[model samples]
Target: MNCRTSLSSWQALTTSSERLKKQHLKTLFDSDSGRFDKFSRHIPGVLFDFSKQLIDDSTFEQLVSLAKESDLAAWRDKMFAGEKINFTEDRAVLHVALRNRANTPILVDGTNVTEQVQSELEKMKGFSERVRSGEWQGYTGKSVKDVVAIGVGGSNLGPQMVTEALSAYADNTLNVHYVSNVDGVQLAQVLKKVEAETTLFVISSKTFTTSETMNNARSSVNWFLESAQDKSAIAKHFVAVSTNLEKTREFGIADENVFTMWDWVGGRFSLWSAIGLPIALYLGYDKFVEVLEGAFEVDEHFKTAEFEQNVPLIMALLSVWNTSFLGHTSQAILPYDQALHMLPAYLQQGEMESNGKHVTFDGQTVPYTTVPIIWGMTGINGQHAFYQCLHQGNVIVPADFIASVEPQVALGKHHDVLLSNFLAQTEAMMAGVNEEQVRNDLQSKGKSEEEINELVAHKIHKGNRPTTSIVLDKVDAKAVGRLIAMYEHKIFCQGIILSVCSFDQWGVELGKGLANNIEAELTEENVAYEHDSSTAGLIAYYKQKRNK
Candidate 1:
């Protein structure tokens, strides 16, 4: 289907792609001595270096021109202005307003969202401080020392990722745990460790009725009741990050403990909202606000920076050029720092679940490829696992290599080794070893000609795989927030360029709706819905084998 917006960028980028096909990273760097300086830029807490990417000055200009043609600036403004950018859902994509540190008046349906945001922030701060100061008591007159966050998808991933990333900064008294899986093993493990007297459960479902979350919540409620043996204890032990007050009240949460979430904030993008209650409770409320401050700084940068210099816009343009123009179907996110181990999974949902759509804005099937598959692990671990394929594989995979300049905790040259590997991998990816170099090295080692000939192909790496290197000062709360927002804006800009509604996740809903129907059949004597032979056979066999 044809895009409703202008296709001028697509046409011009396609032409530019052909001309830049043979240009490699080595050539680009050699041609311009200031390649790194020209391509790299900074936000408040982070440095983004894209010199390793195969983008030259002429092609870079063309890519920037494409972003302008797609009206990325206007689309970005619409999102920040609370316009209904999520067309299919008819909701304004205003995750940005969740962290409006500037106290800017953003109106949604004639009501200012900042007022509600401020109210919620104050509420979160008070609640956290009360718990930390031993004012908010649990069932057995105990202060909270453990927090169990229960929810699935965005609710679970975002908070869990952030807390884990900032674990270095967390205080000693609080131990945060996350239970999102429907499988009882996860919750059981968490429950076995924490006592009802000291544990506070943060039930975080937007509707307060999500299947996995509610099931887990109910089980936890029953478990809490076992210890207290009184219904009133539930109020002291449970708080919620949900919008449905009636459901939360019914489940025994006090009204004051029910934090707010708005419809405009998508779950995947909800961390900047009160959905980050676990983060506040664990790291203290002030640190939580620092997270928002970091993200807001990037929001200002994306909103005001030119396409040529903007961090998010440059990221999106390079991604579009790699995937849509250069035929790469996947990108790797390799963080050198272990604190960011969850980043790949977090971004997998943030990007793929947003721009993975293949539908145009006018409700027609998209003819061209949209979002690429995003996957990776920590850089050092990946060096041992999948660096083989990345070095000498058939498919061209663009990669982002991330690290911090300063280690959070330095001990025994560990950070030095990690940073060295991080730098070497990108350099090796750009300028892969040739057969002659390998052969010379082998001969210098006194290897026979036969041995040299046999190992040459495996040792030769046809270099020029593109990579982006990003370094932060450190992985503090603000830095983590900045990194997350940078990618979020990149996703938005990518959607604008591709003419797809990045905010609405119809693809995820279709799967959930189908799962609901199949869930009903799981309790039936015989399956009712039509299915392929394999599915029907598997279900029938499971039913027959179960003794229940």
Candidate 2:
């Protein structure tokens, strides 16, 4: 396969990127009165405005052409059709099947994955209902009141983010706590809040052998065993989401208590599968279904919508235009809603883990950058913290400003204040205050000419920073579902356009493998592994200090 850089559309985008770099975003808006109308798309719950981005109509069309040239449509179809697009893993990418609410029969390896997904979802619904309704009691014959969800990376982030985002809607029947860190502090802190008898542990690991998750699980079991004194009690308090039933069974969970996930579903995208059991258990199963329904809506739209009007496609195009073409190295995900405080962290893992590869599908090194460093916090906090660097920093960082029209909890003037800042930040970033404007404002405030001249340069903001604004109708379960699904498709489209394998995360595996090797050396004296001077010296120093 030819590199994407060799494509005709890629050359056109390269030229456009050079021309657009000299052009200000304010100039683009000034040249067109209908810029917002032309550059925005409206979905069911989202209004995506990219007019503030540094792109013209011709450039946008060329981006759409780039998508076509890369055969993005064909690739998308193969994914929806359950073909093995995850070539590295030799597995079909079928997280979409998990949320196929239409009940479509998606076949993979001669078996209907849609049927399998539906079966697993049924299990989650039934189990969640049993626990929430107080029918699934503890071994001590007491109703469960607390849930400790133990998993790391994708298993932990997706469900924890969803539960935290929608905690406002929870009825307080159960308190959900997530333990992902292997440091033991996070698990210990959560253990302080609930007793072993009334707390349910949902261990989510596809292989049931992820070092961090398994370590936390074992410690949790040890804590529980101290109270119960019988291994059989583990069956009542501990359930699992894993394909490794033998391992789960050996760990004392019953076979019926184990929910299965297929190899086809990548961990980062497994939230919609039985991995979302904690979500269903936290906020009744119906609400969890709403999340799936929302994502399914975006999936259908992603399939049928034209390349020009499709939001996720547009998102991918913008990312490529900014990163690979314009040479931006980082992007910020700034969510204005407090409910979405974890949004940035969740997307950091989602995009980075998926597309943070240097090589293309054929093992050739990609000529252009693949993925940006994804980072940010809630918008309000970021405004006070990093908006300074954003407004006047030497490096340009494109940001996605996300907000909702309705607040989850309606308080007088709070949402209004939040929306005002969200709107102003994007505008200020795009059309920055010039030296003249700053001088005039200072003059009006009764500052002398000396003061005005001295402060004007420092106050001047060269307003051409690119930002995309996303406004949701509300941040409910359905809207959260739509928001995440849109980004999920965006990641998929980005991988196809960049010619990188998005489904495989070998970089993460390399780190995990190294950590596994080093873990034993930490405990065994004189069992040293060869390393670079930096690593070897650090380990030797730690060992010497401990022996002292």
Measured against the true structure, the TM-scores of the candidates, in listed sequence, are 0.97, 0.99
TM-score, candidate number 2: 0.99
For model 1, the run of ten residues with the poorest summed lDDT: 1-10
lDDT of 1: 0.90
Error of 2 at 481 (Å): 0.8
Model 2: per-residue Cα lDDT over 1-548, one tens digit each: 64799889999999989999999988888889999999999999999999999999899999999999999999999999999999998989988999899998999989998888888889998999999999999988998999999999999999999999999999998999999999989999999999999999999999999999999999999999999999999999999999998899999999999999999999889999988999999999999999999999999999999999999999999999999999999999999999999999999999999999888889898899999999999999998999999999999999999999999999999999999999999999999998889988999999999988889999999989999999999999999899999999999999999999999988888999988878888887667788999998987898789888
Model 2 weakest 10-residue run by lDDT: 520-529
lDDT of each: 0.90, 0.94
Off by over 4 Å in 1: 1-6, 524-527
